[model samples]
Target: MIASLSKISSYKSMNPIITLSPAILGALVVLQAGLNRKVASQWGLSAALLLNAVVLLIVALLIFALVLVKADWFSNTIRPSIDFKTFSIWFLLPGIIGCILVFGGPWAIAKWGAAQTFILLMSGQLLASLIWDLKVEGIAVSYVRLLGIGFTWIGVILACKWK
Candidate 1:
């Protein structure tokens, strides 16, 4: 699996894209949060989130269209007869979580400001991700990872101004 992952550059010819994607994603999230907060202030939170979702859908559809044009894999591998009846209720959890983030993020930013909001959000992500790595991925936590987690919480504590 590791070998296959390391060969992603050979497969996609996008070594730089793969390398910089995370940083790009992080910057985009900050930009989105700020813009969404501004939109919420002008329009309202529900309207802002709705606009965000609509734009996201449009962009996603464009990407799917591009994939359909560029690759046979999507056309050939997508099953038209996917049974919604057979799907578990747990499948909806991710969408629910996404809605929570979409709504909660701007609200939090409005209340606490971006730095504190993102610091607390990062702490929550770190804690939840640690549990997921342990319980779901069956990863054995090392001392180094524990120390990193400790430092993250410490930073969070320092970053958040409690009244």
Candidate 2:
């Protein structure tokens, strides 16, 4: 294995968000399937339910850890370019979990699985987080996050109900 990959994997082990993403994602996927007319299965639903709780716990723990950061605003150090990592993991954790619930499995371990699921999940997570921040902490709106959420929703709807 590449040294960088190994190093990142090791670091991820320590990062709760990174380590628990897949399991939480898998769980959300199962629950969404259960609710949907197409993917409902009793056993899968149960497993998914468990995953949902885990993801929520992880997310809550993450918020709790933010006590150390001492700032709620975006960092000036980050730069003008959009950061994919921020969008994928931080802003969109919940909806991403939802997407994972809908499409996560062996086949989708790293493969292209469902576009709508991906888009909707991203939108729901990022925008919802922004809304939460706006309400809780009076966050100023950022053009990029707003744009991304709007664009992501387009992708979700197209993917889920395309003709």
What residue pairs are clashing in model 2?
28-101, 29-101, 29-102
Scored by lDDT, model 1 comes in at: 0.82
Model 2: per-residue Cα lDDT at residue 127:
77
The sequence of per-residue lDDT tens digits that candidate 2 reaches over residues 1-163 is 3975898878766879777887797567644543542322434544555565687689877755563363455455532446576664466786676555544532232244444444555666677789888998897777877897778777777776773
Q: Model 2, stretches more than 4 Å misplaced?
A: 1-122
- In TM-score terms, candidate 2 sits at 0.35
Report the C-alpha displacement of residue 120, candidate 2, in angstroms.
3.9
Tell me how far the alpha carbon of residue 5 in candidate 2 is from the true structure, in angstroms, after superposition: 22
Error of 1 at 80 (Å): 9.2
